[model samples]
Target: MQKIVILDYGMGNLHSVASALQKVAPGDEVVLATTPEQAEGADRLIVPGVGAIRDCMEGFIRPGFVPLLNRCIETGMPVLGICVGMQIMMARSEENNGVDCLDIFPQPVKFFGTDLKENGERLKVPHMGWNQVQQKIDHPMWRDIENGSRFYFVHSYYVPAENNDALAGETEYGVRIAAAVARENIFSTQFHPEKSADAGLQLLKNFVDWNGQY
Candidate 1:
């Protein structure tokens, strides 16, 4: 049986992500992995987080799962990162008065300007609500999902990856932001797929069926 593990390092909306995975991939064995051993054995993995970047990294450290995460990425397993999880994959973050990250993507997480505005109208800081995402590149995870699909977003900061090729999806919030990023074995999204209704579910379904292709 295929083993799918969601890293349970005590910092994410674990229940929602797990429930979404179960609903999408009922046939697969999904486990909330709190140890490196469990996480390392998974055929596919998800690193989901909801909180400050510093706290999230601290959560991983408290359980000593950083090596496991590095191993997963090194072995090229299918991995997905959501929200703060994705942000921490970058080099560093401006959050928590500046925090260092895992440096998986060689990018930095930047905070949205407080004075952000659209058409001379002030916009919210968190960029909360349904927004259209433009698919920046073709990949297996985006196979069935249509371009400009609306996904739920709630974030005060965004990753503007230095490598344009790594960008998979783009969304605008007073300015363009990287909504999704991808490389060989990793795919991540700033938007919450579980909260995105039909389009979100479809993306999750695609992820389950994906073979870690670019």
Candidate 2:
């Protein structure tokens, strides 16, 4: 059986994410990876978070996390970044501690502007609630999603990868943000799959079926 690991930081909807995975992939063992080596050994990894970017990096401090993550990607271990977890994959985030990220995505994380309005009101800083996502094209990562599907999203910042083509799906929160992104085995999404119902579960299922760099 392919073991699936979820990177557990001090904060995040870890339980929900883990539950969703096992419910979708009953044969896959879902483990919480606190160190680099454990992460490196997994067949698929899920990094899910709902906190700030700075705190998230603390989980990587177990030493060699960055390289382990890179090696996992190189070896084809499917890695999924959820919400803030997805933001940290970029070069840098415009948040408080704004430290360098895993550098998997070339773009920087940016915040929403107060002047922007979706339906005539100032757009909220932390975009919340259920939103619709438009599937851009057919990609294995997004194997079973329809053109427009609603997913639960909660975030203030969004990632804009240098290569626009890497975006698998997009959502509007005053402006369109990369809601879904995939680069080989490395895949990410701004929405919370655990909260997305069937569509989200299917996405997680696809990641479970993903044969990473291997």
Query: lDDT (0-100) at residue 109 of candidate 1?
Result: 90
Where model 1 places Cα greater than 4 Å from the true spot, the runs are 161-163
Q: Extract clashing residue pairs from model 1.
A: none
Deviation in Å, model 1, residue 7 alpha carbon: 0.7
lDDT of 1 by residue, 38-133 (tens): 765688988888888999999977787778877877888889999888898988999999999988888889998889999999998888999999
TM for every model, in the order presented, reads 0.96, 0.91
Q: In candidate 2, where is summed lDDT lowest over 10 consecutive residues?
A: 57-66
Clashes of 2: 6
Model 2 CA RMSD to the hidden true structure, in angstroms: 2.1
The residue-by-residue lDDT of candidate 2 on 130-187, one tens digit each, is 8888887677767777778899998888876335767888878887788988888888
In model 2, which regions exceed 4 Å deviation? 161-163
